[model samples]
Structure formats: structure tokens, C-alpha cells
Target: MPTFKKNQSSTPKINKDNLNMAADAFKESLVNIRNSKTLHYIQRQRKKISENRSASEKYTEFVKKGQDKPRLRDADAPKTLQERGSETVNRFVKYVKHHRKPRDERAVRHINPKHLLWVLGGICLVLIILSGVNERFRAPFRDAASIVVVPIQKGINSIGLWLSDRIEAGKTLAQLEEDNKKLKEQVENLTMTVTSLRQKELELNRLQELFQISEQYTEYDMVAAHVIAKDSNKWFSTFTIDKGTNQGILKDMNVIASGGLVGIVIDAGPNYSTVRSIIDDESYVSSQFEDTSELCMLKGSLTLMEQNLLEFTDVSADVMISLNSALITSHVSSTYLPGILIGYVVDYQLDANDLTQSGHIKPVVDFADLQEVLIITKLKETSD
Candidate 1:
């Protein structure tokens, strides 16, 4: 009967509040375990051991320590070069063996990079001080350093010089190219200026010649004009002038250039006028020799125009005209003015009719090249 009775007090009470309190306590314990200093120390130690076990990391540490305290060679030291070399080899083998073990098992400790720099600077300072105090050690140390560093310094200097020279050469080449372009432009401008000056000079010369011709005919009222156009032929046989009725130019007005008679204005317009020179096929002039006063006829011929000559005919057979006689416009001419020099006579012979003489005469004007002219404004007066 006693075993069968349930013990209510012995059973534990279960509730939501107690379950929540228990869960809170368990979470706080886990947080404390995660943030424990002992656990952090163990993790750091494990990381250091892992790093120490690395052969490359251990070798780096060993080399860093060796550079920390560079010792000067003592003159009285009994240790020979072979002993030092064997010691270095043995120490390297020991470091290799220690790299396979844990961090606590190795004798070497990790050094900071900043400490290595300070150690290197201190060693350099010590060497400099010793070299200053001891002259005997200074020369040998300097010589040994020069043996390794001098060639490297000279090579660096040579490379720097070569680079500097290349840069200067590049700059010089660019400057030369720019200067050459500017020089070419200058040359082109100079050439154009020279050409313009030459053209102006030629124009000046032509104007001077026309001025002289104008002076020669001071007795007559004249107007200067430029030849604007001409016939398709090579000669200035039939041409047009810049002057017209607007300039008081009229038909039959005499045009002269280059020290001789050029043509007569045949048609006049408002702004332009046409002229027919003596070299044309239909042209003729009553003429006479200036020295002899013998009457003759000057006739134009296109065929003889190539030779720059006109034919003189109707000379009396007994006129006795000589070669190179000065031919002039006779006063008896109805259209032409009196005493205007026309041409010179050449090789007169008896015509087929035998009553007259015929020959060629060279005109004074160069018809092949005509530019300007003088127009005699006064027409020849005719009496009834």
C-alpha cells in the first residue's frame, strides 16, 4: 500500500517561466565561454604555432634577426672565416629543424618590421662612427664596399644619362619639326611677296613707256586707255579698249602705242570701244617718205603680219625711195593725221605694171604684245 501511493512533492514542477529562465542562463554561459580570455590566448598561441611551422616564415625571421645586430670584424678575434661559415650553416640547419616544431619549442621569436628598420639604422650609425674613429678600418671597409657598389652606381648613372639624352633628343626633334613647318610657311609667303613685287615692277615699266609716248605727242590732246580685249589671232589687229563714248572716244579716233600708230577706234559704246589696227587685211593708209616727201600707199596684209610688216605700194617708179626710209602719214590722207610716223621702207621693186613701186615696211609697234594705248582725241580736219 506504501509503494502504490504517488508522491506529489517528490515530482519536479515544469512551467514556461522556469523553461525560459533556464534557456537564458544557458545562453549567458555560452556567451561567457566565447568571450573568455583563456580561450582567446589559446587561439592566438595556435595561430603563432602555425606561423612558426612555416619554413619560409622561419627563414624570414632568422634573416631579420641577423640584420638586427650586424657586428664589426674584430682585429683581435680568434674566429677564422671557416669557423664563421660553419657556424652560419649550422644555424641555418637548426632553424630548418625548428620550423617543423611548435612555437613554444623554437628558441627564436617573431620580430616587427619597424624594429628591423631601427636595427638597420643603428648598425649603419655604428659603422659610420667606427670608420670615423679608426682610419685603418675605414680604407679596407670603403674598398670592399666600392668593389660591389661602384659598378652598380656607375650602371645606374649611365642609364639615367641615356634616358636624359633620349628625352632631350625627342624634345629637339619636335622643336625642329615645328620650326621647319614655320619656315616652309615663311618661304611660301616670301615667294608670294616676290611674285607680287615682280608683277608691280612690270606694270610700272609699262606705265613709264606709255608716259614717254604721251610726252612725244604733246601737241595733240590724248587720252590713255588700256586694251581690254582683242581678236583670237596672235596680233593686235582688231581689238577693244577700256575707253568708250563715256570717255569721249569716238569712231575713227587714232590709237597709238609703243612709238607708232596702233589703230583707229571703229565702234564706240557706253563703256567700251573697238579698234582696227593697220595690220588688219582691210586697212590702208596714205603715206609718204619723211625725208623724200614722195607719196606712196601703205597697205595691210594678214600674211605679212606674221613678219610684223605691212606692204607699201603705188609709189611712182622714179620716186627714188631708198631702203630704211622713214614712212609717215601724209597730209593728203583723209582719215589719218599728218606726219604721224607709220613705218620704215624695205626692198622696193618695180611692180608688174611698171608704173609703181611696191615693197614691205616694218611697223614700229609690237602688235604681238599690246597693253595700253594713247587715243588722239582731235580728228583730222577736212576742208571742203
Candidate 2:
């Protein structure tokens, strides 16, 4: 009994006044520490922690307001930093419990192992039958499959074809452009060759005509010249020759082409000459019929030149001038030589005065296409 005596300790009784005094003393001590420079950093850190806690609490409150069921963290008041990890674990557990689904007893009852086996057997049998079917029996099934698969195949094929065609078209277009350039160059070269050949042919023809003219006028000396330029305003009315005074060509020299008289050289220089053609408004030639003694004058007319005709005036009324009669330069001419072919008569009529007759004559010289000429060195006054 003497060994069983327990040591008794006195317990201090805490009233409301004592609790208040203790709390006041603790608060005063905390205030003093907060004001101390040594605890400044600790105070700042504690303030930052308090700000972070307020922000986190506000975010949690906002989340709770938005949700139909408040989260466990949001249901409770703000927690200390030490309790955050446990709160997160509790929230995760709650989330898992909330989303978990209970097994449906009705669904389990609906499924039968025997029924599943039968369905599996039926599927296997169908697969085996399909695999064993003959080609003829499988035709309908293949056709049905093709109805869906063929269109997709065709769409892919069409896209591929379209791409191929575009690629081919691009290549073809480039090739065509290159070919066109080559063809154009070839055409230009051929055109130049053809032009050169045509010029040579024309020169040969002129030479032949000059030989004939020489034979016809054996008494007269002639110099061959090419018509280099013509007046644009009055085409064949005035033209320049290549031959000049150096070639014995002089002023008033009779210029003739293949057919007959072409023009009279009005201006002659050392290396060039200008000829006034018969079609010029200022030109006048003494002409007459080859068979008849009837005399007339051939003159240029702008209005009649378009029809390749010249005006024939001063013909005797009694003279029976018929169509197609050969007209030539008369000996009575001052500038032109005698018997030179002028033109053939086309039509005749009485002149405006009725005292003389006039007619239309188509010149023998092709003035429209005059290219070369023969210059008769001997003038009519100087000729024998």
C-alpha cells in the first residue's frame, strides 16, 4: 500500500482574464518582433505568404461559385501551406469516387454465355461459307462490293488522270512554244532566200528584154538601168534610175522598158537620174496609128490612169481608128524616137470641140510594176 502512492501534480486554472492577458502578451511580442530590423526579412516573407494565400483562396472561391457541387477544398475555409498536399490527395479521392460507375445488373443479365457462343459460331460459319463459295455464286457479292469500291477507285483514278493531263499539257505547251519559235525563224530565212531568187529572176527577164530592144534599135546605143525609187505621191509618174550622166545618160534621154517607151530623163546627175514617165500630168507624146497616117497626141490623165488608160487627142474625124489598133511614137515627136510602141487603142470618141477625136489607150509599158528600164542614149533631135 505504501508503494502505490501516486505523485500528484498541480494543474493551473485558466480563467477568461488570464487567457485574454496571455493573448495580449503574445500579440505585443509579435508586434515588437515585426518592428525589429532583425526580423524585417521574416516579416516580408510572411506578408508574401499571406498574399499568396489570399490569391489562392480567391481563386478557390471563384471555382466553387462556378461549380454545381463545391469541391472539398472550397467547402472548407482556407488551409495552411502544410495541409495543401493532404487537401489535394483528398480532392483526388473524391474525384475518383464521384466519376466511378457502378456495374449494371440488368446489363449482366442480358448477356448469356451460350448466346455469345452461338453468335460466334454463326459468324465463323458465315466466314467459312463465304470463303468456300464458287466464283459464280460470289459474283453478286463482288458486284455489291464494287458498287461502293468502284466509285472510290474511279475518283482516285480521275484525280490521278487530271494531274497527269495537266503535267502533259504543261510540257506540250512549252514544246509548242519552242517549235513555233523555230518555225518562225525558218520562215524568215526562207522568205529572204525567196526574195533573193525573185530578184535574180527579174534581172534575167530584164536582160532578155534589153537584148530584144537592142536588136530592134540597132542604130541607137542604150544603157541598162534599174528603177531604184519612185515618187510615193505619184507612183509611176516620176521615178529615179540607177544610171547617170557618167553612163552617157543625159537630160531628155528616152527611157524605155520591155514593152516600149517608159519616160524622158528630166534630171540627170553624175550617178543618178530622174525620169518623168508618160503617165505624168506634164508629159505629152506625139503618137499615131502604125497602119494609118492619122496623127494624135498621147497625154497622161489622172482619172484615166486608174484604168491603165491614157488620153489620145487631136485625131482627124475622117480617120477610121478602130479598137486594138497599134499606136506608136511618131517621127513628128521632138523628144521620143519614131515607131516606138506606145499602146493599143481601146475606145474612141469625138472630142469636146468635135473638131478632133479622142480615145483611151492602154500603154504597152507596165507602169504599175515598172522595175527596170533601157535608156536610149540618142535623143530624137540627135538621132539620124
Candidate 3:
């Protein structure tokens, strides 16, 4: 109890955990040392020493370490480290460039912007005064400047002129297009007006002809009517008129145009009537020569009508009828009024019996283009 012996068996055993804790403590001590100002200063002094070494010394040291060959040195032969470092530092200082200190921001802030502007204005005024006072002083510079700038100015001017011309051309094209449109409109309007006027003129002339026919037949009560419809193949054969019994038109009423007899009203309705023209194959008229009073029966044929002719027969051989003699409807006719124009004699020949004659007559009416006609209200058989 008086002497205490070391307790070896009580000593703790070292494991991976204890070793790890000791390594952590060592890493923390290293971090503390790296962050200390004394370590920072030592690192800076080492960097300075390395920078002060001559390139020749660095190359020699690299060669001593069994590295690659070094570049040749252009300085004096190798010297001590202190002498070489001093020489290297002195060379660096000889090439070192000293720069002026930057202007203090506080001093710059004290300067007024207006004072700088005034100074610049004074310089510009002096230049202007000098230029005015001595033309020769600026002439050389002006000429030199023009030598370089004249071509550029000319190019700019030409570009401007080209652009202006293009603009004007575009405007002119637009104007021309607008004018062309207006001209087209005017031409169309004129064409329409001309067509309308021509139609009215034709109508007026037709009415005038009808009026003259009415005057010629003063004793007959006549009604003017226009042809409404006809068969295209039989233009002069049969047609409908725009008048009927409502306007006093009756069957067998004589229809006449400007020239002479046209047809007889074969059918009548309340508003329209149908007429069988003298050119129809079924038409037969008692016709007599105006000069000789010779009576003949006129018959229609499609072939004869194509030649503007009608067949005439039953004329007595004693009756003297010559070519171009006018023929009219005879008083013996039941459907046609007396003295109505029928046709003119064309060809004549004696019949096989030798007692009568037959011939062809050219009708007075132009049956192809009949537009309007007059219907005689009085029936040939019923009229007093």
C-alpha cells in the first residue's frame, strides 16, 4: 500500500476509432496553421525568393536534378545565389515601367461639367478664328481631307439620287395604274350609252314608219303591234304578235309592215295573236295586176320564198302583164282588203291549156327581218 506500482493491465487498447480521432485532431491543427499569419508570410517569402532567382540558376538546378536539357543563358556565367538574385532583381527593375497615379475620384467630382464644355468651346472658337484669319493654314489640310472624303460624299449623294428616282418611278407607276383603271371604267360606260342610244333610235324609226302607214290607210282602223315570237326555221312562215281580240284584232285580219302585206291573223287570244305570213306554204291570195286588172291566184312555196318569190297562176292569156308590173290583193279576196299590195310580176308563161298563164312574183315585203306590223281591224268579208 505504501509503494504504488504502474497499472499496465489498466491501460486502454488503441483501435481504428482512436486512430481516426487522432487523425482528425492532426488535420484540424494543420488547417489552423495554414490560416495563421506567420504561415502566410512564410509562403509569400518563399514565392519572392523563387521569383528573384535568375533563369540560368533555375535551368542549372533543373539539370542537376536529371531533367531535360535547359535553354542557354545569355547572361554572365553562373554566380552565387545571392549575387544572381540581386542581379535578377536589378534587371527586372530596369525593365519595370512606372505608371502615373489615377486621378482621385473625389477631385474629379469637384470639376463642373459646364467648365469642360466652355473649354472645349474656347478651343473650337480659336480653331475657327485661325481658319478665318488664314486660309492658307487650313488649305493643305482641307485638300488632304477632301482627297479622302470627296469620293465618299459623292457616293452618298448618288445613292440618295438613285433612291429618289426609284421613289418617283414607283409613284408614277401607281398613278398610271389608277388612271388606266379609270379609263377602263369610262370606256365601258361609253359603250353602254352608245348601245342604248342606238336601240332608241331604231325604235323611233320603226314608229315613224308605222305612222306613215296609218296615214296611207286613213279609212281603216289599225292597231300597231310588234312581232313577239317566231320559229327560227320558219322566220316568215308564222309568228305571234303582241295584240289580240282585246285590241279589236280578229281572225283573217290583214297584217302589213312598211312595204306591203305581211300575213293574216289566223288565231286570236285575249292578249296575243298568231299570224300566217304570205310566205307560208298554206297561204293563198287572190292577186291582180295593177295595170291590167288581170286576176291570178298566188300560192306560197318554201323554195320560192327563199328567192323572195311567190307562185302566180290562173291569169287569162288575154290579160297583158309584163315584168315589174305591180300586183295587189283583188276585191274578190275574202280575207285581204282590196288594193292591198301583194307583189310584182317576175317570170311568166302560158299554161298547158293555153287559155291561162302562170308566173312568179317577187313579194314587196322583206319578210326575213320583220319587227313591227299594223293589223287592220276591219275584216275583209265583214267590213262595209
Please provide, for model 3 over 1-384, each residue's C-alpha lDDT reduced to its tens digit, 9 standing for 90 to 100: 122233488885544444445444543555567556566665455455556554455556655665654554744555689987888898787656222322442377778999999999998898899978864555555455445644464456457667867887777777989999999999999999999999997896799797864433346888998776676785358987767666888878999988599989987765667899988998999988899887889999888877878999999889887899999998888788888887888899999999999999888899887878999888866456
TM-scores of the candidates in the order shown: 0.43, 0.43, 0.43
Q: How does residue 20 of candidate 2 score in lDDT?
A: 46
Pairs that collide in candidate 2 are none
Clash number for model 3?
A: 0
C-alpha displacement of 15 in model 2, angstroms? 99
Worst 10 residues of 1 by lDDT: 1-10
Residues 296-355 of candidate 1: C-alpha lDDT, one tens digit per residue = 888888889888899999988888888998998888988788888888876788999989
Would you give me the overall lDDT of model 1?
Answer: 0.76
Off by over 4 Å in 1: 1-218, 233-236
lDDT of 3: 0.76
Output the TM-score of candidate 3: 0.43
lDDT of each: 0.76, 0.75, 0.76
Q: Where does the lowest 10-residue lDDT sum fall in candidate 3?
A: 97-106
Indicate the TM-score of model 2. 0.43
What ranges in model 2 sit over 4 Å off?
1-218, 382-384
